[model samples]
Target: MKKLSLLLPIAAIPVLVFADNKQMTTVTYLDRGNLQLVATEEPSSFARQITENTPNQDRRHTLENYINSLLKANAIYNHKEGKENPRLIYQIHANNEGTIIATRSEQGKYGVQIGNRSLPVYGINYDLQSDCSWQEQLCWVFYPSSNHQKERWLEISYAPHAIAELKEGVSLLIRNLQK
Candidate 1:
């Protein structure tokens, strides 16, 4: 009976490890070819900026709502949402190889989560121009300037809003994912 008890604990180790690693999710790769997402942060020379005026509280709230809806839709479709961890967004759109993860943990750090490491956001660019292949032109690109590696960087794309509103949405995603 003693051997049986020892074997039971050993078998449970894998389950416990998996439970602890539940935060890891399937990595979503950005299809640059399909989306036509350019890596430039500059305003398109041919296309004019959509809006120069800053977004007010209402506008920002609306943008956040839209982004949240998109996330919820994806989560629901994938059946990844749960009562314990309701908001299962972010971390889906990692870099090309899924090394740099987008994260906003419960402690309030916002940026990419690589492996077991967390970094902070230093710079984010919002390209709001009518130059996209699709109907919408609000392109949000996040370039997290981390000291981890100069050659390696991160790009997170999702956009269509005023600069302030885009920031709000990005903040919301980064915050919600790691929770």
Candidate 2:
């Protein structure tokens, strides 16, 4: 009985260690006014691999490559778009710890407004949440639209960890509208 008891405890240690390591990883990315969230057993590894594989080409191509790499890494979904410049827009990258936000917008037109400032029409918005606090970031891409193209503008808002807030915010917004 004494020998059995010692062996049982030793055998259980691996189980405990494995249980601790079984953590879920989730990654969120936004592109062309769309949002994609990916969950996996090894998120950091997947993200790093994808980012590394992307080519350091021109800014526009690089951005597209990055977004494409992320899409290949996991499932992707469309979020929303601003009414104006639909093509000119932004992308968002967010994890549980921090968020990286980037924006690409047309210049010399009606400016895009985030929070209160008049950002370029094409910009990226991000909301990051942690255990103790939350942060928001934005990036702007300034380029002029061609005269041949219709002067359309688009704004995108992305929050990987803000699903709960988004649901509540939408509900409240709609509720207030009904009133």
Candidate 3:
């Protein structure tokens, strides 16, 4: 009877291990910038964020909405809106230590989840006017100006091809986030 009980518990170990792996997600970390993301397996095209959020590079409402979403998310943790540092959207709780994950909805927007809240995720657009290598053009860079700022990440998928100058901007950002 003792042997059977020990064997039963051992058998359950493999099952539990496999279950945990199945629930694991794909997270990429960008070290230099100190950012991590479980990027949306299905990120919508940059054209979508531009057209859907605003018409023809209006930049007014689109920027405002994006700002509002950040403010909303930041407010949750910091308990202050607008004035507070906006990075709270992607920041994990001190207790939970959860992962930063970006998920795209059928509606084609990325809502990055941090702790218990989901904030709209946006990126800057790299215009590959001629040779567009990848489907995802919105290269979400951590340091836009290479200068330190409160709002580090921005979804600029509609402006220009400046970010395209950097090799694999998206991959670089993700890899550095881990460190």
Ranking by TM-score: 1, 2, 3
Evaluate model 1: give its lDDT: 0.32
lDDT of 1 by residue, 41-109 (tens): 332311122112323323333434554454443331112433443222333232222232434322113
Q: Best candidate per TM-score, number?
A: 1
Residue runs of model 3 more than 4 Å from their true location after superposition: 1-41, 45-53, 76-141, 146-179
Note the clash tally of each candidate: 0, 10, 21
User: Which 10-residue span in candidate 1 carries the lowest summed lDDT?
Assistant: 9-18
Q: Estimate candidate 2's alpha-carbon lDDT, on a 0 to 1 scale.
A: 0.32
Local accuracy of candidate 2 as per-residue lDDT tens digits, 111-152: 643322222222222221112112423211221233333231
How accurate locally is residue 79 in candidate 1, as Cα lDDT from 0 to 100?
25
TM-score of each: 0.24, 0.23, 0.21
Please state the error at residue 70 of candidate 1 in Å. 0.5
Q: What is the lDDT of every predicted structure here? A: 0.32, 0.32, 0.32
2 or 3, which is superior by TM-score?
Answer: 2
